[model samples]
Target chain A: MRVSELVACTGVPLATVKYYLREGLLMPGEATSATQARYGEEHVRRLGLVKALAGAGLPIPRIRKVLQLIDHPDGSLFEVLGQAIGQLPPYLDIPADPGDYPRARAVLEKLGQIYDPRYVAVAQLERALEALEDAGIPMTEERLDAYGRHIRGIAEVDIGLMPTGSAEDAVRCAVLGTAIYEPVIAAMRRLAHQDIAQNFFQKTDEQDAS
Target chain B: MRVSELVACTGVPLATVKYYLREGLLMPGEATSATQARYGEEHVRRLGLVKALAGAGLPIPRIRKVLQLIDHPDGSLFEVLGQAIGQLPPYLDIPADPGDYPRARAVLEKLGQIYDPRYVAVAQLERALEALEDAGIPMTEERLDAYGRHIRGIAEVDIGLMPTGSAEDAVRCAVLGTAIYEPVIAAMRRLAHQDIAQNFFQKTDEQDAS
Candidate 1:
């Protein structure tokens, strides 16, 4: 397909398509003539994935990295994805140092102490730690397990929306799942605070009435 | 406090803080001296909110709009939030034309017909419609209800980890919840697909044994 046809099919503007090509986000099609380039189905699929990643709020550079992983599909995509989702600290870059892992581990341990009675397992903790290590930040195995347990409790609630399947599906679901659920969790936390305030007020009112 | 102080207190880079001011995402503090702008606690709070919104994947312009709503805090914030969250297709953002309302309603209704019996309530549909309408999308009440039910079913399992509160909290939670949960859900879905494939081979082996 010509650039115009590609643009129409993808619902992207011609200028934007050109911009993407210039930015190296889109590969050039075969040069059919001095003025024409012929694109194929690969371009269509790649374009769609690019758009999806962009919509998911990745920057052009990061999207490029993700696209590279998609092209390779050598399990690196999962690693990149795990890093993207698990290490997200309310939207900032993950800490650069493995040394910071201890502090992160502490936070996870504290959370585990709060929720451990709910039945999160040691193996789940190991899996989460492995995921973190795979993503390039190595924490103590013990810390990772504790963190995993806490996250698992929270994740289990979130995972119910997902269809049941294998560990790999679980990993992929974890990626997309975190993308959509973080905002919801934040909102819920705010709501919880509001509820606490309401309960406090109600208790005060009851005492005054008495 | 001067811009430096604001930067120090907020833990934001001076350049980023300046960018926020230039983008109108952060309002300037009082100018105490010719060269120094003195910021106060309000600036710190506003900056935190700005950071949070930015982290939530809103662009600077969109964050500015949301800040405007926060500044006003009358009837507009609800509308702004509605617009922001309701833009997600199929999940929110019902079309405006009255003719489209029925189709929206039908879609929701069909979803409700299919999924409501399992986990969601009729009331959720009502709330969904109200939210859509409040956001200026003008979805039919019936349609809104239908979407609510569909979403509720997905949300029900996840609600275990969520903090339940009043309707206001529900809206806030829904937006943030969706943001965090989407990625996790995607990961789970992928895991499920992988599991199915693995299980298929396992089942084949089992059938041979039988």
Candidate 2:
């Protein structure tokens, strides 16, 4: 396909595609003529993936790096993704020690004792700690388990919606769901005072009516 | 507080703050001394809000405009937010008749019939149509209701972790979550394929045992 066809198929404008090309974000297609370049299936797939990553709030340079990793497949994509998203803080590394698991479990158990059962289930908590450990983050087992359980519990109770599926689906859903909902969560937080104020006035009005 | 204090409080370097001032993204604090300017509570609040907005994916110029609206309070913050986030599409301006509520309800009911109960219920589709009308987006009741229901259903199901309470918090969590989780989700998706392949191998092993 030519540039026009690419744009039509991708729903991206010609100018925007050109901008991406010029920015070195999109690789150049094979040259067909003096004024034309022909793109193929790889270009289409790459463009779609690029759009998805961009929509998910990745910076252009980071998206380029992610694409490079996907193309190579040398190491696990998990490590590449962790680096791309800046999730692995500078001090941390991946593939945590098995010895840390017991401590992490203890922390989660402590968190469970503090919060409601629905907030953080034992199973999900364990998986999250495992994931963090597998990613080689330098959390003490206790801290990892505690933080994992706390965040998970807060997330579950607060979201007011749940996914029904297998353990794998639960993990996948949690990963994707949190990604999209973060903005909505932020917007809601900004409006927190208003929500409280409105609830207060409504309560007063109800008391007067009663 | 002086620029140094502001820098310390915000964890932003002085040069970055100076860049913000030059870009007109931050306002000058009260001039207390020839060489020192005193920043007050307002600066702190505004800077914090600016940082939050920037983190939530708004560009500097758009964040500036949102801050201007908050400073003035002439219009609703909801409107400012809608504009800042580009949530209100341009096509929502087509006019509709005054008595369109019934038509809207019918469309919503039809959507409720087709989509999953959990998705439809979480969307609060009926209420959103009324909100669209209230916001003066100018759609037919049916159109408004249908679109509102559809998007809400998708968002509700797609957003995995709920931070609970406050729109701003939701948006912030969504942004950060997206930033952190996009690559994670991609990794999980790959892992899912691996799981499938593993399952297939296991089944083969079981057959051989049999």
Candidate 3:
């Protein structure tokens, strides 16, 4: 298939395909002649995987590293996924001046997840707490514990889905799911909040009217 | 405090303060003369909120809308949050072609949450399912239901946290948490996967070695 066919079939733009060629993310097709090349099924499959991973929010350079792993015959599937996910930019990049690490550590311990404060996840959680405090919201011990319980539920679901596939096949699934599910889940949460808030607010309005 | 003082006090750069001023996301300080403006406590609070929300991934225009709500006394607290969250760009914006709404609706029905297909949340769910199918992964009803269970847990945490304050006070909390928590939660899930994958892979290695 021609490069244009590749684009038309994959629904990716021509410039992006060219950019991928330049970045060495997608190898050049069979050179039919000067200025023309024929792509194949292999190129099509690779392009699909690349698009899915990129869509999930992985940076181009990191996506390169992941593609390298996917190409390696002996690459551990989980390792590929770990690299894909582990490279995610930290949740919050705030400085340590006013952050309460002791509290964050305590919360992590209470939740049974032992991670260093430097772990991006822990740092991210600390930033959330700090932002809440800065905004005058409390992070009482009881509240943190309750929040932890729910996070554990979400984690279990993510982990549970892991055993469902062989490593190579599952990498794309995880890559896309990681990129996709959060927005879906978060949106659902927002809609759910809207439902609850409407109920509560409606009752308040009625009381006020009375 | 003068404009410089506002910068000094908030720790945000002078250019950012000026940019926010230009964007109208931040109200100008009390002007004693041309090129001289004195900020106050209100400026400090608003600047902090703006920085936190922007850090969370809310765009400038969306931040402007949120700020407008925060300044309006009669703005419903949930409404303020609805806009803040409602403005979140969907994870994937693929055209609705080939997306299985019937499957998505079934998943939602199984989860006991009936939402319209046009709802951003429902549409986001549809996109995720489409990505999974495109990747050749099974979207079994049971798996989605299990995923839903976890999402329900996370949403419960979010809704529980809502009663912490009146709407305005909670807006900053939600803004930061919304901007911050998903990344954090997603990272935690990744970390958890690494842990489990390590265990599974290690056992396999032992079996091979033996």
Candidate 4:
């Protein structure tokens, strides 16, 4: 397929495709002649993933990082998983030392999960815990464990969706699934809160009035 | 206390607090003299919530909407809850007709939850489901139910942290808790993914090799 065919097949605009090519987001095509190059089926698939990530509001550089993980799966499983999820949004500023978050470590330990201090999600979780605590709602290990247990259930679903294909396919599935399914999870949680409050909180108010 | 005392108590900068005042995100203090006004404990608390929301990367307009929800809880429970979560970040351009998302409604029905079509989260979940399906990962009713069930567990924890105080305090707790605890839930999901990938996926690979 020529570049024009790639654009037509993927429905990406011509100039945008050119921008991706220029930015090295899209892999170069095989040179067919002095004036033209040909894209392949793999290029079409990669372009779709890139389009999804960009549509999900990921910056180009982060999309590049995710592509790097998909393109190269030679890293250790844990390292690759960490690097992939580190691409998720809301990047935060962390302190120099991870030791500043003993509570986060304690919570992770309670869940029987061990992580390197420098793991991006660990640092993010630590900061989230701090914010919750500062607002006078301390996150207990019991609560954290409960949240983790339920989250593990959802993670199982996430992993279940991975295609049984090449390493690149698996990486692509995991990263895109994480990025995409998260809003679903968050939205579901909010809906659940609304349902619970309506049922429980309102009932409590009536009982108190009685 | 005066505005300066409120600043000292909350540790928010004078300029930022003044900005919140000018933006009407914080309530005005009672005028005590020609030169100054007296802020009460409520102002201090409201200032803290404003600061937290702003630091959480919410824009000023969204912050104001959240503050309005906190201030006025006289709306129907469903409406208020919908409005509050509607204030959450990453607001998307939802279609005018919620009926466009029959799949989202189906999943909601599967969970035994009913939401007004116009709810923001419903529209968001609809778009998310479309994205997942477009990626060739169709979200089945069973999967959405499973996700919702686990998310309900997390929501139970979220509602548990509500302070037993004024309606204003409860709203503040719910809104801020939702905002702040989301990152914790997200990070936990990622950490769980890494742990499961390490223990489960690797073992599966070794078994295949064997």
Q: What are the clashing pairs of model 3?
A: none
Residue A98's C-alpha lDDT in candidate 1?
31
> What share of the reference contacts survives in each candidate?
0.00, 0.00, 0.38, 0.69
The CA lDDT at A140 in model 2 is 52
Report every candidate's CA lDDT.
Answer: 0.47, 0.45, 0.66, 0.79
TM match of model 2 to true structure: 0.37
**For model 1, how does the per-residue alpha-carbon lDDT over B1-210 read when each residue is reduced to its tens digit?**
888888888778999999988888778778887777888877887786566445445667666665554455444333433444432222323333334444324543454333221111222233334333322234334433432343343444334333344333343343444443443333332233233334444565689789
Per-candidate interface DockQ score: 0.06, 0.06, 0.36, 0.67
- A88-171, model 2: which lDDT tens digit per residue? 111123324433445334653554333222211222334444443332232354433433333343343322232333332233
Candidate 4 lands at a TM-score of 0.89
Per-residue lDDT of model 4, residues B14-130, tens digit only: 999888889999888999888799999888888888888776778999888877777777576546656776777768765478678787788888888756677777877787888
Would you give me the overall lDDT of model 1? 0.47
Question: Which window of 10 residues has the lowest lDDT sum in candidate 2 chain A?
Answer: A115-124
- How do the predictions measure up, each by TM-score? 0.41, 0.37, 0.75, 0.89
Output DockQ, candidate 3: 0.36
lDDT of 4: 0.79
Off by over 4 Å in 2: A1-210, B87-210
* Candidate 2, residue A137: how far the Cα is off, in Å: 23
Interface RMSD of each: 12.2, 14.0, 3.2, 1.7
After superposing candidate 1 on the true structure, give the runs of residues whose Cα lies further than 4 Å from its correct spot.
A73-78, A83-91, A96-107, A110-210, B1-210
